[model samples]
Target: MNVVKRQIDLKRMFTCTTFADRVRFLIELAVTAPSTHNSQPWRFVITQESCRLWFEPKKQLKEADPSSRDLFISLGCVLENFVVAAQYYGMYKEVRLHMKENFVAEVFLYDRAAAHQEEYRSLCESILKRYNARGLFERTNIHEATLKRIEDIAQKYTEQGVRLQVVQNSTDIKNVAELTAKGIRIARSKPLFRKEFAQWFRTNLSKKQDGIPGYAVGLPLLPSFIAPFLMRYCSLAKVLVRKNTESILTAPAVCVIESDTDSPETWLQVGRLAERVMLECYAHDLATSIYVAAIEMDNMSQELAQTLELRGRPQFLFTCGVPLTNHRKFTPRLSVDLVLK
Candidate 1:
């Protein structure tokens, strides 16, 4: 399951007494966007006219995402949120994506952000409310009408080569579930990979602002605490492998988001598209849980690409289903002060 990053007391930020305050407000919203393992792998520098967004190299999930796919994708999600928030706040955003050292994307916010009006109102509203719903989802099939609407929302802004495919056929779903299980086995077999993966699981909310807290990922508080200690055992992961496959099959539908190539730009597109799909799902009262580790496995990913008939590289896999519960808790983020330069 996913949760909103804890919000900063923006009473201080909303004053807009200065242009910096205005920029800060939008950055606050942008960081609320999701990241792999709640890594929060980004930083920003704000000027009166624009916001320079950068990826934190130290924040990269090197072990889990050596190719840095999840890293850039997470940044892309943040950029989308920043754009939407800027639009709603009345600032025209000219975003330029490039690579310079640790930089990912930069936005020049013009005062003339045209009125978004009703176009993205619902999607923006779903921003804070959207969490990774990772638990059991109802087995009821998603309506055909809902599928069409979701397809309509999945459209991309550029020809930079990104695509979203939904899987519903029982055979296709089984293929995805089995592939995900195989990916898990491949990763869990390694002792170092398991060790690095366990470090990201924050046992309690009070422990750290970033990283996946146990409960937010569906581990109850007690298991959350014990997870770290038991995470070293390969046997523990084996026991839970069945749970992953079974849960994935329960989704009403699974979304496979891919890009034409594996580059910062394409991964960024994947991130933006993934968030768009998630927000659309949220508007329809569907919950989403992103599965990245399995997608990171090359063999499993190739099988997924062939199974889904995706012309491009598959970067993300997530499920959408009716939620069994209304999860109010949110995964936390580092405070704005820490994220801002």
Candidate 2:
């Protein structure tokens, strides 16, 4: 399918005459959730009144995320989108998390009037509009009200032991930026890591349905084609470190998402919280860029938690602000038919 048609399909809310059709429509929104490297590491089995979500082990990033932490977190993003879309249509019943089974989550559906339907409907709209903003951000601090609103959204997840900490102080932000630069350098030093990451980088004109396109990161046609080769064989660590550090410093604030525990279930919850926060930011005309290298590495994560005086384990990190340039080109997604079981 072409880009325009795919966008329309994702944005359209099809009228459904059956429960299965409703579930399928919701899955269209669910797949729009971001994944590490656009791996889209998930599968779904649709039924008459429910949908089962499973983690696809084959899509796991072995060198980049060997513990499957990011994979489970990616699944959490899928769950959040599915539930948000369901509530918009008044078809969400409840969702049960499965730890011991092959499926990670099973969402039950029922046809009825939904509470806060308008609220969720707005968020559902954001599912299609939201994108990972990259490059330099505007050099202005976020409004106090906007920051409070984001904090309130994060507060809702506190009982679940997930917290979102926003760092705006110049000193703290600079410290975090240094840690991020150091972490990226360490991660890229490994040959296996570079090779694994290269496999997901695609040229701008390529037609692959899943993977990060060159344009999404401001790469031109020629550079996009050579990105994989450069990443695998070239020592671009110093350049990457400088670029990432500058980007972090330019942002208004650095947000850190933490969980009280480290498990698949908590990781899922963190993912949900992270996605909701991103949507909320986009709703306010703000852009967010996720930077997880510091949080993904154990030593870096430990140092980050200490620097921020955080009480829980940090699961995700990102920067949010007005963007110097808007990123309209979206990363590709695997079709619902391709991901269905």
Candidate 3:
């Protein structure tokens, strides 16, 4: 009798509560969306009757994201999950794009029979479980079947114009490696970058409630008072160059997301697509991280774009690391109530 009761509880836990309840559940999953400094810079408004989703730009990261590109992309990540989660709960969402003042999307829902229900639930579940993996992954090679699964997920949005270029060849992968190393060197060398890094670096990782704690960053701080000041003066590039460059470029695969124009809307689209790929990769037991700092350089950006055969500018670079089998627990996040505005 106890076993039967436990099974019933498990089934209920996975069942849909209501349209409003599903939206609430999906927003909680959306908190898993990645940010530049674990900024968690996104908010959502939902009208359950109409099932409309709106993006609110109340929380913005001023220093790191000046143009709000990262924030919008992070919102896209949440929107992506909302779409998938909606389907899992027997609803389909149609996104309406508005582009006069700033790029914002209004999503409306409809009830439709979905052919691939289980797959949608699998992707939605992954959103709840995924995290930005900072640990060194195992040297295991990702299988061809897993690559194909990613491609299958990529084939979904025909409109809004998203192009996914996977780096599969040895030569191309090596070039990305070199470009990423160069990017890391550039990011580390900047005084402002180091200053920003110092601000987010909390000495007491355990006591810290929000922000990127010291432990999650995986870098030891200099003294508490002196680090920020020194970060203001030092060349971060010079510091990273001293480290082993080759070791940093060993991710299993690298993907570049491109857009025809560098508009705010396009960045949002790229963000949505990136969330899709990242969540899908997580479901397949693949670890992932984004590398925007690399494309900050002209030479590195051009080199990576050419490797991917991408015609347009390479807007974002995401390094998909296949875990080496051994896994680490995810970084902690703020409670859902705190994250939602």
Q: lDDT: which candidate is best?
A: 2
Error of 1 at 292 (Å): 2.3
Which residue runs of candidate 2 sit more than 4 Å off their true CA positions? 1-6, 9-11, 112-116
| TM-score for candidate 1, residues paired by index | 0.91
Would you list the C-alpha lDDT of every candidate in the order shown?
0.78, 0.84, 0.62
lDDT by residue (tens digit), candidate 3, 1-341: 00000011212324544655555555565566776676565555666533333444644655455567677777677777767766665566577766444336666765333344685766766766566655455566678898887877676642677777787666776777677777777666656667776666555334544456544434454454454455556765554443323333566677778777777778778888889999888777777767676575535667777766788778677767664334333445566556444
Residue 118 miss distance in model 3 (angstroms): 1.7
Sorted by lDDT (best first), the order is: 2, 1, 3
Name the better of 1 and 3 by TM-score. 1
lDDT of 1 at 170: 79
Clashing pairs in 3: 138-324, 188-236, 188-237, 189-236, 189-237
